[model samples]
Target: MTVQTWTFVIVGLTFALYILIAIWAKAASTKDFYVAGGGVSPLANGMATAADWMSAASFISMAGLISFMGYDGAVYLMGWTGGYVLLALLLAPYLRKFGKFTVPDFIGDRYYSNIARTVAVICAIIVSFTYVAGQMRGVGVVFARFLEVPVETGVYIGMIMVLFYATLGGMKGITYTQVAQYCILIFAFMVPAFFISFQLTGNMLPQLGFGGKVADGTYLLDKLDGLHRELGFAAYTEGSKSMIDVFAITLALMVGTAGLPHVIVRFFTVKKVSDARKSAGWALLFIAILYTTAPAIATFARTNLIQTVSEQPYASVPEWFSNWEETGLIVFEDKNDDGVIQYVGNQEKNELTIDRDIMVLANPEIANLPGWIIALVAAGGLAAALSTAAGLLLVISASISHDLIKKQIKPDISEKGELLWARIGSVLAVVVAGYFGINPPGFVAAVVALAFGLAAASFFPAIILGIFDKRMNKEGAVAGMVVGILLMLFYMMKFKLGLFGGGTKEEWWFGISPEGFGSIAMLINFIISFGISRFYPAPPEDVQEMVESIRYPRGAGAATHH
Candidate 1:
């Protein structure tokens, strides 16, 4: 079959499967909608959590970023992986033991104040919306190339499909669908790696293949380094970012992972505190299958890209080049009126402009891989984006319906009314998310990193203190979240979005980029929270006792709704 036919078939089957699961596991109650009735087993939850955690950023964009950024991309790998460990070990069990529906529920109950819950809900919405925008953008990119549609049209399509499943089934549906998505995406990601690995180095393991020798007995990394030097670019193995920036970005990502409301909510779906821990372990194993392969895939994609296109004749470019060119992801300008393509590092001399987001998607075509394998990649990219988008949309809807409306505005609202409101919230959230998708702020990974910064700045400190410190009161948590999120927003807008009289890179505060500034904001939050809490009286006696109770593992029951 042709690539388009294969894409349609695979994508159609996967979509049908997801819709079937959504119908089969449709959420009937507020508890089911929110936490899948809190009866999910560890293994299923593990697969679901891994799928939810690995969004478009991981599937379509992470390897692409690593291909272009070279060694500097390690921050993302280290930060995100380390952050998951921090969340699973330090936060998940405790939160599950607390038996709350959402992060806002924990804060509200722990602090004994609706005000704290409101603040947490706002932060959750902001963070989840920012993250979901990246997922939608990923969907648009995949559809633009494989489905041969405009990016806006693609976003609309993705929004409709997600809206159908998410509003209909909620967490219950999303969880089971993600389990299937994990299998598809992981298989899709690895098949190409195996093929490319053996074709390049006579080895099936991509990890070993990248370090192995080619047919001419030249080391793969050495050849890539030689290519970089010949093209006036830095060596692929050398780092360009400063040590402090790398450290800050890594730390920000780590803590941000812990604070991400969507990922944290995954633990709540498990049966008990121990089950949450077990799912975390299972999730780490499932997640590692992809994370470990990414660097190898990055190397393979980068090497193939440079060898295939650099200084090649524009007229003789492969079918894949023209295919992507029609999508506007690959641009050839013939700047010097020469027939040759210049893909150099210097912007002025580079005649070929390639979008980084296209590297992973285009890798198979560049290497002359089979059509079916290439089409499978498109399906994988969609699975990754849709899975995460569903999870984030759930977080946004739950924040509005469960936290803002039911808990605060109308405490007397019936269960059916709350479920209706939750579905309504899902519709509104998807509309806003689609707008951001159609008009994304940046490329996939960059937009996702900014969302992580926001999460790190706002939620990490409050959640940590709420659990570890008995004296951490509502006033302090509320103040810290407000200031932290505001500071992050200011830095992100001024630097990343170029909004506040947009300054140049040279004007960065303390020489930190916007992606890494979350660490500084998080630290400030810790300080402000500590400082303000001292002025107020300690938390109520029962609140303190509850805080201490969650620290232990024994006697913890199933996750509760309210």
Candidate 2:
């Protein structure tokens, strides 16, 4: 069968499976809608969390960034995964034992302040919206290519599919559906990885193959580094980022990972604090399967891409080259009016430019793999994009329905009424997110990176301090979040978006990029929070006890809701 036929059959089969799971697991109450009845097993919760964590950026764009960023990309690999350790150790158990449906719920109850809760809700919505834009855009890209539709049409279709399941199942349906999605995404990711690993290095395992010898008896990393020099690129095994920059970037990502509301809410879906811990471990393990293999995929794709495209005549270039070029993902100028393609490593000077986001999705085509494998990739990319989008949209809906309407606007609203508003909120969020997907303000990678930075600046300090510091007052939490978010926004607007009349790296504070400014902003938040709290009277007696009680590892029972 042709690639299109395979894509249709495989994608259709996977979508059918997700819809079936959602139907079977439809939510019947607010509890079911919010936390999947809070009875999910550790293993199941882990799988769902993995699916939730690995967005389109993780599945489609990461390997591509690593392919080009070389060792500098370790910031992403380490910081993202490292944040999970912080979550499992620092926040997950405490939040689970607190036993609420959402992150803002914990903030409201712990700090004993409606204002603090409102701040958290604002931060959650902003962060989720920024992140969901990438997932929606990713859905559009895959559909545009595989389903042969306009990007706007693809995003609308994705919104429809997500709206169907998310509004109906809430967390209940999304949890089970995500379990299925994790299976499809991981299998799809690993298959091509294994195929390419075996073909390139005679090792079936991508993790081991990345460091092992290839056809010429040279180690893959060594060969990759060597080829990078010959091609005017930074060495694959060495990075140019300074030690301070790397440290700052990595820490920001770790804290941001621990702080994202969508991922944090997964802990509430489980049975106990122990389950939260175990589920985090399981989530990381599942995530590691793909994380460890990404560098290998990057190396393989980078090497294959250079070997196939560089110095080849335009007319003699491969079919995959022309295909991507037609999509404008790949472009050439024939700078000298020569027939040859001058594809350089530092792409700015080269006649050919290739979009890094296409690396994973186009890998199979570049290697001339079978149609089935290519089709599987399309399905996998969609699953990754959709699963994460569903989770983010849930957070958005829950914020408006549970936090805003029920808590702030109408305290006496019925649970059923709140659920209806939640569904309406989901539809609205999906529509706004789909519009951004069709017309992104920036590249998917850059947009999502800003989301992480925002989360790190705004939420990590507030949530962590609220739980760990007994004396931290509502005044301090509110002040810290506002300051943190403002700093990040200022830096991003100044550097990335070219607002405030624009700026450059030379003008950057301490030479740290906007992406790495979160670490600085977070530290400022911590300092300001503590400084302000010291001037005020201590937290109320009960609030101090609430903070102290959370320190213990025992007694995993749920907290009493107000």
Candidate 3:
């Protein structure tokens, strides 16, 4: 088949597969919709959670960012994967024992306050919405390439596709669909990495390829660093970011990963607290495969681009580079009228510009992989984007219908009415998320950046302390969430948007970037929450008993339909 034909075939088959799963696994009640009947196997839940995590950011952007940032990008590799350690140990099992359908449900019941639940619901919605927008943007990128349409139009297409599965099958549909997603995405990712590794370094293992000698006999990274300095760029093996900033960013991502509502909700779907713990182990194991291979891919892509394009005649540039040029992802300008592309660090001297986000998407074409492989990648990217979008939308809808409306505002709401409202809420969220995809904010470089910070600031502290600290009261939990999220929003708007005036990293508080500020903001949340408990009354006796019970490994049961 032709490239376009191949793309359509693969992409169509994947969508059909997801639709079939959604139809077969359609949710029957609120419990099924929210937590997949709370009986999913540990292995299945692990695969589902892995799919939720190996999102647009992981599949598309993380390796791409590392391509540009060199060792500075280690933050993402460590930060994201490290959070599961915190999750599996510090949070997931305990939350699973609490026997709630949602994170807000835990907060609400633990604090014994409707107001705390409301605050948690709002945080979940905001974070999930922010996260879904990024996924929509990823879908737009894939659709734009395959359908030959504007990215905006493609985003709307992606939104509608996710809306159907999410509304029809709810959590049950999303979980099984994600299992399929894990297979497709991981296969697509590994194939290209292996192919490129063999072509360049005679090593099928991308991990070994990074360390192995190339045809020229110099170490690959050494050659890359040499080429980088030759082009007036920093060494590829060394990081240029400040140490403190790296520390803060890594810390923020770690906590943020543990705190994200969509991820936390996955543990709730498993059959028991033991399953939650085992599922987390499985998740980290699977995630590590991709994580370990990414740095090698980043190194290879950077080296290949420098060697292939630097100082080459513009007229002689490869077909892949030209193709991306048409998409505006790669740009070349002959500033000196020499008709040659001088890709130096300085824009005045460099004749080519490449967007970092396109690194992974364009890698196959750069390596001259087969058409079917390229098409498979396009399908894989779509799966990564759509699966995560469906997961996030589920949490967004549940937060609005189940947590906010049914529990707080209309306690007497009918089951059918609440499920209907959940579907409606998903439509609204998808539409809003699509809008963000079309007209992205200048500062929203990666969806993971903003979403992680917001999650770290708002939910991480409240949930952690609520689980461990038996004395944590409603006032403290609510106050911490409100203060932390508002502070994060204030910083992001002030610095990222330049709302009041121009903002830059130079004006950052003690050199902390907005992404890293979440770590500090979370600290303030911990302090304020503990401080509030001193003046206010403690959690009720029964609420304290609930906290104590959550610490145990036994007695996990399926959450009933409200």
Candidate 4:
């Protein structure tokens, strides 16, 4: 069969599997829609969570970022995964034991203040929406390349598919479909990594191959580092970022991962607190399958790309070069009119635009791999983006319909009416996200970082304090959230948009980039909240007892009190 034929067959089979799973696991009640009826097996929940958490950023952008950033990208790898340890150990089980439908629901009731809940809902909506927009853009890019559709058309197709399954099965359907997606995406990711690893280093294991000697009898990493330095670039294994910036970015990503609502909600699907813990361990294991392979792919792709393009005449480059160049992903400039593509990195002499997002998507092409592998990657990218987009849309709709519309605006709405409104909210959100994907205001990865910063600064402190500290009052939680969010906004505007004034990172108030500002904002939040709570009144005695009950696993089955 032709490669395009195989592409059609593979994508068709995957979609069919997703639809079957959705039909088999369709939700029957509001509870099932919200939390998969709270009966999912830990292993299945773990797989679903892995798929939901590993979005387009992980599948497409992460390896690309690493390929370009070299050692500095390790922060993303270590920080994102390390945060899960915090979530599993400190947050997930307690939140599951609390037996709440949403993160905001737990915070509001725990602190005994509707205002606190409203702030949390707003923060959740902002984080989820910003994150989902990038996922939609990933879907568009994948479809535009492999499926031969317009980017906007690709987003519409993704939106429709998500609506069909998400509205039909809710979390129940999403969980099963995500399990299938995780399988497809992981297989697609690893197959290319293995092939490329063996081709480059004659080693079967990608992780070891990354550090092993190349076919030319030189250590791969050492060769890469030498070439980078010779070309006026930073070494592949070392970075130039300040230590404080590195520490802050790592901390921000760690805390942000713990604060994400979709990831936290996965714990609610498991049956018990112990199961939640087990599921988190399993989720990390599944995630590691991708996380560890990504760096190897980055190394292999970078080496292959540089070797292929370094001396090739610009006009003689392959069709793939022209194809990607048309999309503005890879551009070339024939400085000195030599008509040869100079791939060297000269800090002062070279001016070329290479979008890091192209690293993974163009890897197979750069390596001259079979067309089937390239097509499979396109499907995998779409799967990653769509799964994450669906999860984020669910969170956004729940914030509006469950928290704002039902709880605050109209408490007497019927169950059916509430669900209808939720579906409406989902559709509206998808439309807005689709528009932004086509007309993004910034880079995909950078936009996602802003979302993480916002979530970390606003929700992480509130949720952590609400669960673990009995002395925390509504006043402290509200004040902390306000202070954290405002501080983060100030940092982002100063660096990201230059709204505060004409300034750059070199002139940052404390030499802190916006990307690393979340950790400081989170610290400020913790200090302010804890300090004020000490001076003011504590949570009521009953609330304190409730907090104690949530820490234990035995009483989780008790009927939830409104």
Task: Please tell me which predicted candidate would have the highest TM-score against the true structure.
Answer: 1
Could you give the C-alpha RMSD of every candidate to the true structure, in order shown?
1.1, 1.5, 1.7, 1.8
Candidate 1 vs candidate 3: the TM-score winner is 1
Cα lDDT over the full model 1: 0.93
Cα error, residue 63 of model 1, in Å, equals 0.3
Cα misplacement distance, residue 438 of candidate 3 (Å): 0.8
lDDT per residue (tens digit) for residues 1-562 in model 3: 6777888899899999999999999989988899888888999888899999989888888888899989988898888988878888898877877778788888888888899999999899888878887888888888877667778888988988998899999999999999999999999889999999999999999999989999999999888989988899878789887889999999999999889988989998887677788999998888998899899989888888888888888888898887677666677877899888889987678777787877887888888889889888898888888989999998899999988889888999999999999999899998899998887763123666878989999999999898889988889888999999999888888987888675887889879988798899899999999999778988778778777777753435542222
lDDT of 4 by residue, 407-447 (tens): 88898998887887777888888888888888875766777
What do the candidate models score in CA lDDT, each in turn? 0.93, 0.89, 0.86, 0.84
Q: Write down the TM-score for model 4.
A: 0.96
lDDT of 1 by residue, 126-172 (tens): 99999999999999999999999988999999999999999999999
Candidate 1: clashing pairs of residues: none
- Tens-place lDDT per residue, model 2, 57-155, is 999988988998989887899988898889888988888777788888888887788998999999999899989999998888788777777777889
* lDDT-superior candidate, 1 or 3: 1
Model 1 error, position 362 (Å):
0.8
Off by over 4 Å in 4: 553-562
Poorest stretch of ten by lDDT in candidate 1: 553-562
TM-scores vs. true structure, each candidate: 0.99, 0.97, 0.97, 0.96
* Top model number, lDDT: 1
